[model samples]
Target: MAGSQGPLVLGPMLRYIGETDATVWVETAEPGVVTVKADGREWRAPTFSVMGHHYALVVVDGLAPGDELPYAVRFGDVVVWPLADSRFPPPRIRTIDRSRPTRLLFGSCRTSVPHDREGNSSNGVDALRALALALADGEEAWPDVVAFLGDQVYADATSEAMRDFIAERRDITQPPGEEIKDYEEYAHLYGLAWSDEAIRWLLSTLPSCMIFDDHDIRDDWNTSWTWQEEINQTSWWHERLMGGLSAYWVYQHLGNLPPAELARDEVYAQVLAAGSGDGAEGSGIDLTEPVFDLSRRVDRHPEVYRWSYRRELGDCRLVVVDSRAARVLDPDRRSMLDPDEMAWLDEQLTGDVEHLFIGTSLPFLLPPGLHDFEAIDEVLAQGAHGRLVAAAAERARQTIDLEHWAAFNEGFAEVFDMVIDVARGNRGRAPSTVLFLSGDVHNSYVAEVTDAAARHGAQSRIVQAVCSPIRNPMPRVVRVLMSAFARSLVRPMHFIAARSRRVPDPAFPWLVTDGPWFDNCLAEATIQGPDVAIVWRGGEVRDGDDLHPVLTTVGAVRIPGGLDDGARAGESAADGRPTVAR
Candidate 1:
C-alpha cells in the first residue's frame, strides 16, 4: 500500500503474458477508469464490482515475443505504482520467447507470515521471498514465468495478520471467525498475501499463473462426498464457498484467460462496456448481482465453468489443472475431474512440444506406497470390505487426505493412459519429455515411471516433480507420518486392493528418486532443446541479515530429450536415478 496516493490497492501484477499481448490485473480503492500504460501504449478497462469490491483487468496489445515491457497503472491521473521518485526499479513484464530457453519457477502452499524472527523460527524462511531476492542479483537466466501450483494463500489457515483483521471485523469468539467469512474477507486475505515489498515487486514483474488447492478455501476441500456433506451443514459454509469462488474469479482466475477468451467472458464484457471514468458517462453501473450469481453457480456446479488453463510458452507447454473444483463426486463413480474436464485435459495432454508440463496442484504421481494406500482406502471405503470396515475406511481417508488420483481409479486410469499414449507418440510428435509439475503435500520430491517395458513403449521420458509450502512448513508429527508412509509396505496391500476392485495395475511402475524435502521451498525448471532440467531450492537464514533468507539446494534432476523408442531402455528414470542432495 506504499503507493497509496492513487486508488490501486493490491496489483498492477502482470498475468496471462503471451507473444503479442499481456494482462495487468489490479484491485482498486474505488470503481473507476483503470488503465495500464506501458511501452508508449495503453489499454483501458473499466473497474468492475462483485459485492462492492472493485477490480480491473487491463489487456495490453501490440507486443512481440520476448518483449521486455515495464508497465505502470493509473486511475484518473493518479499513479498507483512505483510511488513518486521511488528508488526501486520499475516492475517489468517479459513475454515468453520460444526461441530462447524456457524457465519456470513453481511452488505452492504459502502462508503470509511476517519475515521476522518469530515467523522464521516457527515456519522456516519464506522461500518465495528468497527467490525474489535471488533473482534480484542479476537478470541472467531469470524465469520467464512462474506457476503457483496451488495454495498461494491459506484461506483456512489464517496468519496472525489475517486473524487480527478478522478480530477487528467480527467477534473472535464466534464460530469460524478466524477463517475468511465473505468476499470482503477474501480481499483482505489477498492483500495480506501480496503486500510484502520483495514479493510484491516480484509478482508485479513475473508473469504468474495460479491454481488452487484445498487450503485456498479450506484444508481437504472436496476430499470426499461425506466430508462435503458434513461441511455443507455448517452455517458459514455457504458464505465461505461463495466468497472463495467469487474472489478467486476476480483475483486469480480471470487473468488466466487469453484476450480472446476474456472477450468471450460475459461479465468482463459488461465491465468493458462500462465507461472508463467516473460514472462512465452515466455508464458506471454496479455489477454485483450478476457477479455474485455467477460465483454461486460456479461453486455449486464447477463443471459449468472451466478453471483449468494452458499456456504454450515457446517449445514448452504448461497446463494448469483445476483439480479441486471440477470434481465428479458420485459415490459409485468418484473422480477428481468430471468427464468434461478430463476430456478437455486429454486434448491438452499431448506431444509435439519439447517439454509437456502438467501443472496439477495435487501431484498426479504420488509415492508408490502412498498411491496404493489411497487405492486400498478407496476400495475399502467403497465396501470391498464389510460395512463397518467401510465406514472406518471412509473416516480414515478423510483424516489423511487420501483423495488423490489413485483414490479415483477411473480418473487415474484415464490420465495414466493419456500420459502413456502421449509418451508413446500416439498423440503427436512426442515431446522429448512429459513432466508433471505439482505441489500440495507440503514436501518436495522427484518421481518417475520405472516400468522398463513401459519406458520402451514411451517415446518421451516421463517424470513427476513436486515443490510445496513456500512458507507453511508441515509440523514435525505430520513429517514423521509422511516419512513413515513413504517407507511403508502398502505396495503389496495396494496390489491386493487393486485386484479386489478389478483395477488394472498402473501403466508405468514408478519410484521416488530424489527427496521428500520438508523445508519451505521453491522449484525451477529449465528446458533447452530436447533436454529438460529441474532443481528444488529452499531458503535458510544463515547470515547476519536473518530477514533475507539464503537459497539452498534441495535436489536436482536432468532428463534428456528425444527418448524416441529405446534410446534410454536400460535406464529407469533419466540418467540412472535422479541426483539427490541430502
Candidate 2:
C-alpha cells in the first residue's frame, strides 16, 4: 500500500451478450463506495482487498444489442473515472450483430512505457492506440471484438511508477527487495499495467478477450525442461510464480470469462458463491485464502485445472490456449499443453463454422529458417556427436526456451493433427478457412498451409495470420539478421531434420512461401459472401503532426466456398490452392 489516491479504473473491458450488456471490472485507488450506471440503471458491488489492492467486478447487465450506451463510475458521489493524462473520451456502449460475421482486431505484447513526448514521434502506432485514434476520428468501421492475445504487462520489467509504489511500501534496500518477488509487488504491477488512459478507455468501450504469455510472468516461460529446471532453483521463483498467478485471477482472468463459465469455474465459483451479510460492504468471502490455495494446487498438479477458454460468435469459434503454466515439463516427454488441454482443443476443432479461429500466444508456424534451426538443435539433443551434442543441446534449450513451437513437439503435433483433420474434411463441414490468429513473435506476418494432396481432392488450405508486438518493435539490425538467417538456412535445416531420425516429419510440410518480413502491423480478416478475405496492414510513421496511419497491404487469401458448403464442395476448393512445393 502506497499513499492513497482517488481515481479508480473501470476497465480491462469485456463485452458479452451482444455488447449491450457489458461486464466492467474495476480497482479503486482507495477503498470507497464504488457504483456504476449504464442505460440509466445503477448497480452497486462491494470492493475487497487482496494483498492491499481493492477490486470490484460489476456486471452492467441488461441493454439492447447493437446500440451504443454511455456509462460512468462514481466513488462516494464523486466522479473518478479516467484518472489522468486522458488520451480518449468516455466509453460509448456498442453491440454486436450475430446475423452477420464480425471483424475481430487482435494483437498482444505491450510494455507500459510513456508514449514519446511529441506523441507523433512514437516509432510505430500501437495496435490498440491506433484503434482508439480511429474510433475517435470516426473511422469507417470498428472491430466488433479486440482479442488482446497476451503479455499485457511484464512483471519482471517493472516501470518507474511500479518501482516507486513498491519502494514506498517496503524497504527494497534489503536483498531481493526492489524487484517484485511476492504477492504484494504483483498487486502493484497490475495497477500500473491497466491504469493507462488510452487503453482503459478502449477496453471500456470495445469488447475484449485476453490470454497470457511469458512476460505476463517472466521471459522464456516454459520453453523446455532445462529452462524450468533453472527457474525452479532460484530462491524467489516460487513466490514470483505464485504472486503472478494469484494476481492474474483477481485482476485479469476473472473478467475475461463469461458469467456461465465463471459460475462453473472451480476457484471462481467459490468467490462468486461466497457472500457475507451484516452491513459490511468490503467484507465477503476472503479472496486471498482460496486464491492462494488454488494457485498452489494448480502449480503442484498442473493437470487439475485449465486456463484455456473458448468463445463462439455466430458460426465461428475462437479457442484461446494457455501455453505457459499448463506444461508437461518432463525431459523425456515435454509438451506446451497437457493431455486434458489438448483433448479440449481437439474437441473444439471438430466443427464446420464459417470461420474457426485458434488463438495462441505463440505462433504455430515460425520462419522457415528458425524452424530448421530448431530441428538441428533437436537432432543434437538426441546425441548427434558426443559432448558437442550435449553442450549444444543445453544452449539450445536456454535460447529456444523464449520462442517457437518446435520446443513443445508433442503438444504442437497434437494441434497440428487436429488442425489438419479439420482441413481435410474429417470433421463435419470444413470451415472456409481454419484461421490461426496469434501474437508473440514481436513482428507480424501471414502464412498459409496448403495441402499437397488437396489437388487430388483431399483437403483445403489452412491459413495462419499473425499480429504481434501491438506496441513493441524489435531493433532494425535484429530484424534484418533474423530475415537473412531464415532465408539462407531454412531449407538446409529442414533437410537435415527430415533426414535425421531424431525429429519426425510433420504431417503437413509448411513453408514460409509469402514472407519472413518484420513490421508493426494489425491483421484484419472478414468473411465476404462465399470467400474469406484476410489482409495484413503494416503501420508507417507519419511525417507531420496529423499524419494518417498508413496500412500497407502485405497479402490477402480467399477461401472459395463459405461455411455452409458440405464436405463435397469443400474438398474441391480446399485443394485448389498451390502447395509450397520444395
Candidate 3:
C-alpha cells in the first residue's frame, strides 16, 4: 500500500542491464514491496532502510536479449511510478545485445541547481537535461550505457536549496558549515541532484554506472599523505567520510555491480538478513550502523572493499577504476593504486575485445606538457630538492591540484607497460583501439600517441578522451591556461623533463588530437565492430526557452578502424578547430 508520504522518493534508476537480467534501484517512501512490471511479467523486492530512508534494488530477470519493454513500478498494491503527468514516454527496459555495436555516454562533475534561466546563465544549461529532452523527442538515439565517471554530487559546493536544507537542521556557522555532515544530509543532497524531472526520467530508462571523485566528499579528497593527516584531525571528518561512503554504497556503488556480484556482497546480504521492524511504513531492517561500520572499516583498510569494477559489453571491455580510493600515499613511493588494487587491475587490463575502454575519473594520459609538470612536482615534493623545497612543493601540489596519473609515476609506468604489452599483442589479440576514457579535469579533449604502425610497430590506436562537468563550467582564465599548455608548452616541458633525474622518458610520445574545450558537456563514445567515434555535446537554450535546451554537438572525432597509419588517422580538422564529423 502506498503510504501517506509519497510512494517514491528518488529513483527507479535503471542500472547494470545485461543480456538476461537488469536492476532497477529506487528509494521508496516506506518499507514496501517495490514491483517492476514489463512484458506481462512482474518482479518485486523488499525495501531496506538506511537512516530511515527506504530503498529497493529489484532484479528483473529472464528477459530476452535486445528486448525493449515498457516498465512500471508499483508500491505494494498501488501504481506509484510514471508519475501520471510525465511529459516523457513510459520508461522502457532495453537489455544488452552482444551482436550490436556499443554506445556509451560519459561525463562527470555536475552540480545540482535549478534549471531556470538564472541557473542556466550562471552554470550553463544542464547537459543531462538537454539529452533527456532530446531523447524524449526522439532526436538522439538511446545509448547502451551512461558511465558517470565521478562527482555525481558536490557535497562541499552547496546550492541554494541544499543550503536551506542544511540551515534548517544545523548551525551554518559551525565547522563544515553548509557542507553535508551525515547520511541524512547525503540522502537529501542526492535527492536534489537526481530529482529533476527530465534527468530523473532519463535515469529511469537508461542504464547508468557511476564512481565517486573528490567533490563527492570534499575538494582535494585523498590528494596526498599530508592531506589525509590534516583532514583526519578535523572535528567532523569521521562523520562526513562515514556518511559519504555509506550513502555512496546505498545510492551509487550497489547498483554498479552485476546481479551475481550484488548478490554476493556481504553488507547487502547483512541488511537483507536483518530483522524487519513491525510492518510499519518506515520500519524495516535498518542498516545505518552496519553501513557506517563498513565505511569506517574500509577507510582504515581500503583493500577490504574494492570500488573498481569491470564490464564486458559485447566486443568492448569497460574497466571503471577507483582512482581516488586505494592510493599509496607514502611520500617515498606514491602510487595511484595500492599493490592489491594494482594486481586486480593488471588482470583486468588484458586486450581481446574490439575496443578496450578504461573509465578512470583521473586521466591516465594527460597532455604531455601538463604530464611533465606533474611528474616533476611529484619528485620535488618527495624531497628531490631537500626538506624546505619539498615542503613548498607539497603546498604547491595541493594548491594547484597536481594530483593525477602523472603524479604517481610508478603506477603510471606500470599501467603504461601493460598497455604497451596489450598494444603489441603480447597479452592477447590486440584491440583496434585502447581508449582511456576519463572525466575530472572539467574539460574535454582527445589525445593520441602519434606514430606509424611502422615506427612504433603497435597494432592498436592508443588514445585518451576526456569529458567533464555535465553542468559546472571552469573559469575563463583556467581554460586559457589549459589551452596555452596544449598549444605551446610541449617542447619547453620536454627540455624541463630532460633535466629531472627522477622523471623517466615515455615509451611513446603523445599529443592532443582534438580539444581543450571547456563547455559543460557530455561525450558519447560508440564502438562499432572495429572502429570508434566520439562526440562532445552541450546544451544550448534557444529563443528564451531555458526549460528545454537543445542538445548541440560541441565537437566530434572519428578513429578509423585500423592500425596507426602514421599521422593520417590522427589528423585534426583542416581549419585547426574541432569539427562535428558527419
Ranking by lDDT: 3, 1, 2
Q: How accurate is candidate 3 locally (lDDT)?
A: 0.85
Q: Each candidate: RMSD to true structure?
A: 2.9, 4.2, 3.6
Model 2 over residues 293-405: C-alpha lDDT tens digits? 88999888888877888877656778888888788877577787888887888888865677788888888877666665665675566466677776778676666443367
> Could you give candidate 3's per-residue lDDT for residues 231-307 as a string of tens digits?
99999999999999999999999999997887688787764455243222332667778888889998999999999
- In candidate 3, how many clashes are counted? 0
Give the C-alpha lDDT of model 1.
Answer: 0.80
Worst 10 residues of 3 by lDDT: 573-582
Which clashing pairs does model 1 show? 530-561
Candidate 2 similarity to native, TM-score = 0.87
lDDT of 1 by residue, 228-289 (tens): 99999999998888888878888888888898888788777676566544323322457777
| RMSD in Å for model 3 | 3.6
- TM-score winner between 1 and 2, please give it: 1
Q: Judge candidate 2 at residue 203 and give its lDDT.
A: 74
By TM-score, the best candidate is 3
**Cα-based RMSD of candidate 1:** 2.9
Model 1, poorest ten-residue lDDT window? 276-285
